[model samples]
Target: MGMAVVTLVLAIPLLAALGLVLVPGYRTPARLNIAASAATFLASLTLFVVEPAATKWFVLDAFNIYLIALTAFVGLTTSLFSAGYIAHEIRIGKLKPLQLRFYHAMYQAFLFTMLLALSANNLGVMWVAVEGATLTTVLMVSLYRTAAGIEAAWKYFILCGVGIALALFGTILMYMAAQPVMGPGMAAMTWTELMVRMPEVNPKVLNLAFVFLLIGYGTKVGLAPLHAWLPDAHAEGPTPISAVLSGLLLNVAIYAVLRFKMLLAANGAAIAPGPLMVAMGLGSLLLAGFMLYRRRDIKRFFAYSSIEHMGIITFAFGMGGPLANFAGLLHMAMHSLTKSAIFYAVGHATQIKGTQRMDAIRGLTVSHPALGWGLLAGVVAIAGLPPFGIFMSEFLLVTSTFARQPLLALPLAAGILIAFGALVLRVQQICFGAPDGVSKAVPVAWSLLPLYAHLGLVLVAGVWIPGPLVAWFQTVAALLG
Candidate 1:
């Protein structure tokens, strides 16, 4: 019964998405999409109330339960944001009703993909789910059919497609690697079964599998060198889509990578996954830190920030102590909330300004004070400033890193400082000083509510995590090892 409910929770959005495309009325589809997403979130809430257990093709455990809840929660909020955002796009002639229909359908499909990736008990199923998300977003990214939008969508499709293909190869290699020990059957490929039998798997096969999987899923995670598709996708897609890309999609991708890392760890003789992840994590941090100073598009700027924080989280896991792992988990949750909140504000700002060019956008404080300040607060929080959950999590990551590897601390600190300065400079230009042009006011009621809710949650978590949640995180972090 539990497995059936969980499967239904994951599948509802995909079914709704198909209905959204086939159904005629716009308002009805929009309402249905929002209601479906909200119900999905409510169903995921059962994770906290229900005990941990495995069902035939799925498992409910500490490691994934919170992420399931978080993904569903963010999916609901983004659906609400999309409702308003697409409506505004139609109102302004930026998008036609036909495109809005595509947008609505694609949005639900994207949610369904992420949910599947999170809940899958088989590694191959998880990879397939991640690939499914990549395909859905390609359509959404190109919904505008503008030159830039089309180009961005193509780039996203090509890169992520190739990356996911590599990940699939890695998955196959893992299966092959496990077959000798666990025997060639479905039993050899199940994540839980593999974890239990991993110690007996060949070390050489595990090492090679890790290398391929890292570069493959790492692309989806937006790690550097593999990250070229991210900025264009963010710059051209609907802002609500950008919100989910940074907030939810990237987290889902990282989750895929972590699952593989767990498999590698279980094979005791395999080369430690820590050093490779650490190197990639540090490399992404340094690259994104330098790249931050040069972004002209606001969304692109934050996309790089997503890369930077993912690096930090990757680094935390790479460090591999209980404290670092705990901090990594917290950072992932905090980054998803804070980054998505920022994108929410950015979406509204771009809409009001009628352009994404940084220079064309100025004096957001005068134009849309609610959105302007919300972006500013989100910026402050994401830059690892105090009173935000990111700051506390980042502080813990750095402290843990310093204790173990003091020399690497300088570059880490430098990256944080550089990102901080760049974010403040661009944000100040947009939010304050002089009015850029004629100002337009959006309804403060709907747009600002989700932004503030996310920010307030990050803030509260920074000050203190409730006992139940903290305990939950600690348990999950232990499992990460």
Candidate 2:
């Protein structure tokens, strides 16, 4: 039953993509897209009830089950948001009907690749899936065919392409390390098999492999120095694509890194992966915090916010204690929901106001009360304000760091404050002050349901986490260590 669920989850998107290409017109495909995504999400939810199991090609476990479910949920919600969003674009003549067909098709394809990456048991397959996701999104990022959009797409491709290549080399090294113990074959590349025999694997080879993997996968995670591709892609791409990039793709990359980190931990002789992750995480957090203050494009500003939050989650996981690991997991969930909600609101605001410029978008509350308040709530949640899940997770991370390493806590807190101040300032300017731009009201739709639902979850989780969920996180936290 579990395997069937897995197969169905993977198949829905692939089948939908094929059908979408053949289907004529926008409405049918858009509706079909949402239905397919909803089906996939339902399939993913079943994994929570099933026992952890593995096939020769895939595995289901605590670590990935929640992530898969979250990815599916977000994918479905984003598709709902896209229906209204793309319809608006088509009406305005910004996107042709043919482009809408292509967009729906690629959206399913993108979802397929991400689910494949998360579910794959073979390290090589996971890498291929991540690469496929990059390729699919590169096309989407360039969908506008504007010079700027094309440029962003090319940068995304070149940078991530190079990074994935490095990751491939690292995978080869891992296989070589495992060959001596597990013998040369598919088994040597199997994640489950590798984990069982990791202690006997060559320490030197594993250490070097980890370095490459960290740098390689870290690039995809939008860690600094390798993150040049991220902002441009987010700014240029469709809003739904931006949400997926930040919410799903980055998490998948981090999941890959965490898998490799587990391998290193299994081998006592290998160098500790924590310090490297810590350094990179801190670098991304501090860099993004400062960068946030300078963003003129609203989407780009949120893009930087994604980087900052990714850094925090990375830092928490790098800390490696049970408490820290749990915090990291919670933060990942909160950031994904909150960031995507913000992007949803931003998408509508930009369309209504006919601009992405923050300076031009003022007094949103007066202009569009629902959207303005929605954006405000999203910003507040993302900025780690109280009564939101992000704040709870961030608090856990900060306290954990202070208890374990006082010096590290200083920079962590500083980065959080820096980002917090910048986001609050920008949001206040946009939501308050004199009313400006687009006084005409846009029709409200069910699409906004996702934004509110996400915020609601964040709010509820902050105040009261269910016991079962806490237990699940604790189990995963132990596995992480």
Candidate 3:
């Protein structure tokens, strides 16, 4: 049953991707995409019920099981949102019928790569999976074939190409670091084996390997300075892709970083990775905060917001304690849900208004109350407002930092406040003002359902968390240390 579940989890997406490309038309492929995503999500849930499974290619544990569940859930919701979104695009001639076949195929392929990366037991295979994710998303980003879209895709491809190459070098370095201890076999490249034997590995070489690995995966995580590709990719890609990129793909890179961080922790002589991660996280937070102030495009503005939230999550993990790590994990889940929900609302709003520019879209509440209010609720949650899941996570992070690293807490709080101002300002302009006379199509019940479902979960999380989930996060937090 263990093997069957894992196999089914992967096989569904792989088979669906191939079949989707051959299947013609819009509705059937969209339904298939949603169905495949839903089945994969259900399969991933069985990981928690079944015992942990570790084979040559895949491994499932407390560390990854919760994340796999989160990824699968978001992927399912995004597919639900995408089905409606793509149909509208086709109606307006923005996307031809045939392009959607490729789109559906690539979407599944992207999910497969992410799931593979998270579940991988071998270091080399994990790196390959991350690279595969980059390639698949690049094609999707340029699906519209516009000048801006193509440019974003090229930029995404080149920057991430360089980043993945660095990651490959880092993977080699990790294998080299392990080979001496494990003595030249598959064990040297295996994650489970490496963790078991981490203490015997040379700390100096491990230190060097970690630096390269951090930079390589950090770029994909959208850390500042290396985040050049993120905003462009988010702004120009199909909204469904943007939704998953934040909700799912970035977490894959974060998962990679945590995997290596575990190795570093197991070695007593290795340099502390916490301070370095904290520095990068702090830098990304402040940089994104100020950048949000100058943003004109709504999606780009929120893209920076994603960076800021990633920075916050990184900072919490970097603090390295049971409380901080727990907060980081919670924030990771919260941000994924809240941000993706925002993108869904944004996708529909932009469709009604016919533009992504902030100035061009106004009076949404007055004109389209459902979308306007939905977008408002999403932005509020994302901006770390009270009575929402994100606020709880951010509060925990801030308090944890104040107790352990008070000096760092000041800037972190400031960055959050700065972003809050910008988001509130921008959302107010779009939701409350006079209507732009361009809206023709109203979003159907299915589109809004997924958006509200996500936000609803987040809201519930703020006030009450399930007992089992709290226990699960606590277990993983210990493992992180």
Candidate 4:
């Protein structure tokens, strides 16, 4: 039953992608897209109830189950938000009806690839899935067909393509490392088998493989230095695509890195993966914090925010205690919900204001109070302010860091302060002051639902984390070590 659920979850989006292409008209595909995504999310939820035994090709466990659920849920909500969003785009003539059909189809394809990447037990298969996601997103990023859009798409393809190629080599090295111990066959490449037999694998080879995997997956995670493509892609793509990129795609890439980190942990002689992650995470946090002040485009500003938060999550995981791991997990969930909500609000704001420029979008509260407040709440949550899930997670992370490594906490706190100031500063300018620019009303339907629903959850989480969630996070946190 569990495997059936898994298969169904993976198949729905793939089948929907194909069906969407043949289905005529924008409204039909849009509705079908929401239906299919909701069904997938339902199937993914079943995993939490029915524990599936590890198979030769796939595994259901503490680590991936939550991520699967999160991915599916976000996919569903984003599709809901996209329905209304795409309608606006069409009405404005920014996108044609034909392009809408293609957009809906490619959206499902992107979801399918992300699910495949998350569920695959074979390292090679997971890499292929990630690459597939990259390709599908590249198409979506270029859907506008504008020179800037095309440039962003090409840059995304070239950079991530190179990263994926390096990842492939790393996967090959992992297989070679396992071959002697597990024999030269499929079993050697299976994650379950590799985990069980990792200690016998060559540590030096595992170390080298990890390096390649980190750089490869890290590129997708939008970690600094390797994150050049991320801002442009987010800024140039459709708002819905930007939501998925920041919320789901980056999480999946981090998941891949976490999987490899586990393998390295199992190999007793290998260097600790924690330090490497910490270094990269710190770099991303500091760099993105400083960069955030320079963003004129709202989407790009939030894109940099994504990079900064990803850095914090990475830092938490790198710290490696049960508390830090738990913090990382919580932060991941919070950031996903909060950031996507921010994007949804930002999408509508940009459309209503006739621009993505932060300077042009002013006094949102006065112009469209609901959206203005929605954006305000989202920004506050994302900025790691009090009474939001982000604040809770960050608080735990900082205190945990201070307890274990007092000096390291200094830089971590510095990054947070820097990012918080930038976000608050920009948001103040956009949310307050005199009303400016166009404030035409866009139909508020299921679009705002996602924003409010996500914020409500974040608010609840800040005050109280449910027992089951805490326990699940505890289990996963133990696994990380």
Candidate 5:
């Protein structure tokens, strides 16, 4: 049953991507996409009940199991959101049916790659999976074929291409680090074996490999100085894709880094990866917060928010303690839910306003109360306001930092405040005041279900975390050290 569940989780998407290529037209493909995503998500849930069938090529444990479920859940919700989003695009001729066929295929391919990356036991296979994820997203980002879209896709390709190259060198170095101790071959490259044997591996090679790994995966995480590709990709690509990029892809990259971090933690001689990660995380947070005040495109604006939050998550994990790591895990989940919900709202708003420009998108509350208020709620939650999951996570992170590293807490607090003010200021301009452009009523209430569902979960999580889940997170945190 365990093997069956895992096979189902992977096979559904791979088969669906193939079947979708032949299943033409708007309605059927959209339904098929949702159905496939739903099946995969259901299979992912079974991972908790069924024993994970860990093998040489694949691994499932306390960590990746949670992420696999997350990836599938978000994939399902995004597909649900995509049904209406893509239909609207087709109605307006922004996308052709042919393009959507390719888009759906690539979407499944992206999911398959992400799941593969999370589940892989082998370092080389994980690298290939991550690279595959980049390729699939690049094709989708260029779906419109417009010059700007193509430019964004190419820019994404080239920048992340460099990142992947650095990562490959790092993976080789990791293998080199393990070869002498483990005596080479697949056992040396496997994550489970490496974890069992890592303390014996040389620390210098581990430190050197991590530098390349951090920057390489860090590019995908949208950490500043390496985040050029993010905003453009979000602004030019379809909104559903933007949601997954922020919600799932960034999490996947960080997941990769965390895996490597664990190996480093095992060796006493490896440089403390904490300071370098902390520096990168803080820099990204500050850069994104200030940049938010300048964005004209709504998607780009939220894209910057993603960078800011990723910084916080990275910082929390870099702090390296039980409390901080737990906070980081919570923030990653909250940010994924909140940011994706915001993109979903932004997608709807742009469709109603006939533009993505903030100036042209005023009075959303007056024009479309559901969307306007939904956007406002998402922004509040994301900005770390009270009674939402983000508030709890950020508060824990800030308090933990203050308790241990007082000076670092000040910069983190400043970054949060800077971003908070920018979000509140901007959301008011967009949601209130007089109506701006086109104000046609959204015909479907069903489309807002994912938005409400996500925000509600975030709300529930703020005040209470179930005990079993808390135990699970605590276990993962201790494992990180």
Candidate 6:
């Protein structure tokens, strides 16, 4: 019953999204989107008071409980922002009412897909959920149907499609490995069951599975070499969608990778998943850091930053100790918060400035102080400034790496510094100048709410984490190993 509640909470938005297609009313879709998301938020809130729950189809543990809550919370807030953002787009003639309806429906579907991925007890089900999310996001990405939007969407579809197919094969391989230990049945495929019997599975197959799954999901996570599609998607998609892509989609991809990591850790004979993760993580960090220097579009610039931060989180997790895992978890949460917040500001900036080109945008601080400084704060926070959650989490990760693997720490730290330089240089150009772009007086205060709220929570967590949260993380960390 408890697990059903979690599943149902996630399902409502998706079901409503399907219902949206049948409804002819344009305004109704937006209202339905908001209501469905709000209800999911409230339903997820119930989980905080209830004990953790698990079943064959669903499970709620320390790790995913917080993730579910956070995902739902952000989903609700983003839905609210979408209401206004899409309305503005419709008003400006960029989107027709028919397209607005489609946007609302797709938004709900995306929420459902993430929730499903987070809550599924079966690994196969989780993969299906993530694949569902991929399809939904591709539609949303191409909603505008501009040549650039269509091209971006197609690219996202093809790359992610190939990646997800590999992940499915990996899942099947894991099932094959598990079947010998747990019997040739569905029980062997259950994530909870597999975790319990992990030691009994074949290490060789598990090693192969990890490689396939990592490459598959890592593409979605925007790790380097496989991240070519992300910048274009972000550059061409709606700003609200950009927020969710950076804030939620990438995290879901990482969550899938973590699941595989847990299984590898459980099988004692398998080569430690840590080294491969570390290599890929470091490679992504280094690649994104240098790539940051050449972006001409604002959204693409932050898209690269997404790759960089995802790399940092991946590296932390790859290090795999109490301190490093905790930092990785914290970094994941903080990056989700900080990146989405940056997108909120970026969305508004593009709306006011009429273009995404970095060169066309100048002196935001002179014309729009609220958005300008809000963006500045987000950039500083993401760039690892003190007093922000990102800075604290990153500090822990670096310190832990230095203590454990000093040799690897040099390149990791260098990557961060390079990324910092690129962000600061670009931000200086965007935030301070002679004020050339056309500006609007429209107050997008509501959209700013989620951005600031996330940043505030991150700051609080950095300065003083609650006792319960800390305990929860420790428990999850142990489970992770």
The candidate maximizing lDDT is 2
Worst 10 residues of 3 by lDDT: 1-10
Model 4 ranges off by over 4 Å: none
Colliding residue pairs in candidate 1: none
RMSD of each: 1.2, 0.9, 0.9, 0.9, 1.1, 1.4
What tens-digit string does per-residue lDDT give for candidate 6 at 328-439? 8888888888888888888878777878999988888888888788888889899998888888888998988999889999999999999999999999999988899466
lDDT of 3 by residue, 1-481 (tens): 6667877888889999999989899899999999999999999988888887788888888988888889999999999999999999999998998677688999999999998898889999999999999999999999988999999999999989999899888889988988887899788888888888999999999999999999999999999889999999999999999999998899899999999999999987899899989999999999999999899998998899999999998888889899999999999999999999999999998888778999998988898888788889999999999899999999998998899878999999999998899898888898997787856789997789989999999999998999999999999999999
Model with the higher lDDT, candidate 2 or 5: 2
4 versus 6: better TM-score goes to: 4
Evaluation by lDDT, superior candidate among 1 and 2: 2
Model 4 accuracy (lDDT, Cα): 0.92
Query: What clash count goes with each model?
Result: 0, 0, 1, 0, 0, 0
Off by over 4 Å in 2: none
Error of 2 at 250 (Å): 0.6
Tens digits of lDDT, candidate 4, 31-143 = 99999999999999889997756777677888888999999999999999999998898888999987766788899999999998888898988999999999899989988
Candidate 1, residues 203-282: lDDT per residue as tens digits? 99889888999999999999988999998998888898999999999999989999989888888899999988888888
For residue 351, give model 2's deviation from the true position in Å. Answer: 0.6
List, residue by residue over 1-481, the lDDT tens digit for candidate 5. Answer: 7666777888999999888888778798888899999999999998987665567888887788888998999999999999999999888888888787678888898999999899888899999999999999998898889898999999999999999899999999999999999996999889988988998999999999999999999999999899999999999999999999999999999999999998898877799899989999999999999999999999999999999999999999999899999999999899999999999999999988878899899999998999889999999999999899999999999999999999999999999999999999999999999996566548379999999989998999998989999998898788887
Estimate, for each residue in 346-365, the C-alpha lDDT of model 2 and write its tens digit: 99999888789999999988
Candidate 4 TM-score to native: 0.99
Better of 4 and 6 by lDDT: 4
What overall lDDT goes with each candidate model? 0.87, 0.93, 0.91, 0.92, 0.92, 0.87
Estimated TM-score per prediction?
A: 0.98, 0.99, 0.99, 0.99, 0.98, 0.97
Superposition TM-score, candidate 5 onto the true structure = 0.98
